[model samples]
Target: MKYSREELEEAKRQIDSTLHKLRETIKTFEAKEEKARYKSQITLAKRRVKAFEIANYFIEEAMEK
Candidate 1:
């Protein structure tokens, strides 16, 4: 997918914010169910962050060409 620099920056910011929230939530919870939910959220957030990073790299490469 094609992404502009502005969009990539926005995505990066949003992803970072989401990851932060997920990590904090994970840290706050101690119950099994709550911890499971937070763990899943954290895993999902990490995957999203990585995906966006790859997409940003593609955008960078496209910018160079």
Candidate 2:
């Protein structure tokens, strides 16, 4: 499928928003005893961070192309 520049820009905004939410979630879960309860949340945040990184990579690649 082909994407317009505007579409990619919107996708990038969504990825950034999701990453921001994940970061906030991680902060909310930051407590010594709640670590166990928040393990999954932390993992999700990690994955989101990775996805953010990958999204940025694609954005750069496409811009370069």
Candidate 3:
């Protein structure tokens, strides 16, 4: 399947937003002694990183097209 340039741009924006939120959550967790929340935040951060990679890939593909 092929994505339009606009679609790719939107995906990148969404990924960026998600990553920013995850980072903020991690910072908040760091200020507390909630082990479960901290662990969940780490997981969320990892997922955001993966989403970023996917967004980057789509953006590159769009550029090539």
Candidate 4:
């Protein structure tokens, strides 16, 4: 399905907001006294951040097209 430009813009905004929150979460995880406790969660969040970044890139490319 083809999305309207407005919809694509909104999607990008949402992804940006999510990425910001995820980064904050990673920071908070790292700041813990026992960093090892959050290691798995941190790793998962980092992977998610990367995946979202790729998704956002694709969205931008689609918008360009």
Q: Highest TM-score: give the candidate number.
A: 4
lDDT of each: 0.64, 0.80, 0.75, 0.96
Q: Give the per-residue lDDT digits (tens) of candidate 2, residues 1-65.
A: 76778888888888888888877888878755768887887887888889897987797677566
Q: Clashing residue pairs, candidate 1?
A: none
lDDT of 4 by residue, 1-65 (tens): 89998998999999999999999999999999999999999999999999999989989998999
The candidate, 2 or 3, that scores higher on lDDT is 2
User: Of the candidates numbered 1 and 2, which has the greater TM-score value?
Assistant: 2
For model 1, residues 1-65, the per-residue Cα lDDT tens digits are 77776776677667567656755654555445556656766666567667756766765666666
The lDDT leader among the candidates is 4
Task: Report the Cα RMSD per candidate.
Answer: 4.4, 1.8, 2.5, 0.7
TM-score of each: 0.50, 0.77, 0.64, 0.95
Sort by TM-score, best first: what order?
4, 2, 3, 1
Error of 3 at 63 (Å): 2.7
Q: Ranking under lDDT, best-scoring first?
A: 4, 2, 3, 1
> In model 4, what are the clashing residue pairs, if there are any?
none
lDDT of 3 by residue, 1-65 (tens): 77777887787788778778777776777778776757876777768777777777868777677
Model 2 lDDT, residue 16, Cα: 83
Pairs of residues clashing in candidate 3: none
Which candidate do you rate higher for lDDT, 3 or 4?
Answer: 4
Which regions in candidate 4 have their CA more than 4 angstroms from the true location? none
